[model samples]
Target: MNTISSALWPWLALAGLGAFHGLNPAMGWLFVAALGLHRRSRGLVLMALVPIALGHALAVGAVLLAVIVFGTVVDATFLGRGAGIILIVWAMTHLLTGHRTPLRIGMQTGLAGLALWSFMMASAHGAGFMLIPALLSLCVTPGTGVELAASPSVPISFAALAVHTGAMMAVIGGVSLIVYDQGLAFLRRGWINLDILWSLALAGGGIFLLAG
Candidate 1:
């Protein structure tokens, strides 16, 4: 109880970070939502958010694990340089190849597929970069050092990530469902243009991350 309670603030902070990232247009939930709207299926739209969220959680979790395993050895300088190079390469690939066709929302790819996609995209975009700082802030806080050192930070991080991703999907899915309900034809009419926008946004984000 007291031990469990002591871990609450860090977890909450992590969750908040997840939510913040989820809200970013570059995270790809908007693209998923748009697909849902194009299909004119509210259920599918709502369902799509699940795998997307799971994918994001997996991506962030992997980063956290990597950081823990390589603690101190992997500082911001290494992460920044490595992540920058990766992002630059990815962006160049996108620029050369152009955007692929948007994925159709369905049960075939399902949750697993969605999670995989989300993880890949988030990892490519350095989603975990944001999460690391949040965790470090908690751990380095003046009075909480001992508590943080004793607590299972990884599990707490994952739990917060799950909640944050869940909330984001809910918001994006709900908005998509509403758009579909009100103007399915309008959404369908604009789907291709929207795809272009998604590609450009992703490419730009990648470039910015690399340069920053």
Candidate 2:
């Protein structure tokens, strides 16, 4: 049971972090929603998810690939500690700056533009970086070539990425639909902000990586 729990927690963490990113308006939903509003087309909103998701996946995949490459040469301890510190510092910056990104990619963007915007936003927000802790938890420590490739960890990493991205898309679609149908007034009326919680989560993830 302990072993099972230990293995399961990393997948759970990936899903949870995905959900958290999905919940963040700065991620992609808000921008897509605004774009939908501008175009007056619900279909466009739904369609846009494709590109947004693709872009996000690419950003995350790039990070994962880099991690995998580094995992072969660099020590896991060093990588984890470095990633942890980066996450903590990134979180501090987000908290201090109030998550007010200078991103002006606007609603006029086409699908390609939206994809680029999503990629940039995800990269800027360190969305993929947040997954490093959970990611490394699943990978074998400092593995090399075929040894690493033969392990279940590589396939599991792909599964983790799919699971993470899927969870995010689910939330993004759900929230976007609600906002489209009901309008933005509801958010203005009584929405609880999650930016602070996000920062805290990032910092907590950092601490977890470091302690691990």
Among these predictions, the greatest TM-score belongs to 2
Cα lDDT tens digits, model 2, 46-86, are 99999989989889878887777776667777778888999
Kindly list the per-residue Cα lDDT of model 1 for residues 1-212, writing each as its tens digit.
96665557556655665555555545655666666665666677777777777777777778766655554345443444454455445555556674343534343455677667677777765566545544554344433222233246566556656666666666556655656566546455653333344344445534543453
Indicate the TM-score of model 2: 0.90
Candidate 1 global CA lDDT score? 0.57
Prediction RMSDs, each to the true structure = 7.4, 2.9
lDDT (Cα atoms) of all candidates against the true structure = 0.57, 0.82
TM-score per candidate, in order?
0.57, 0.90
Look at candidate 1 and give me any clashing residue pairs: none
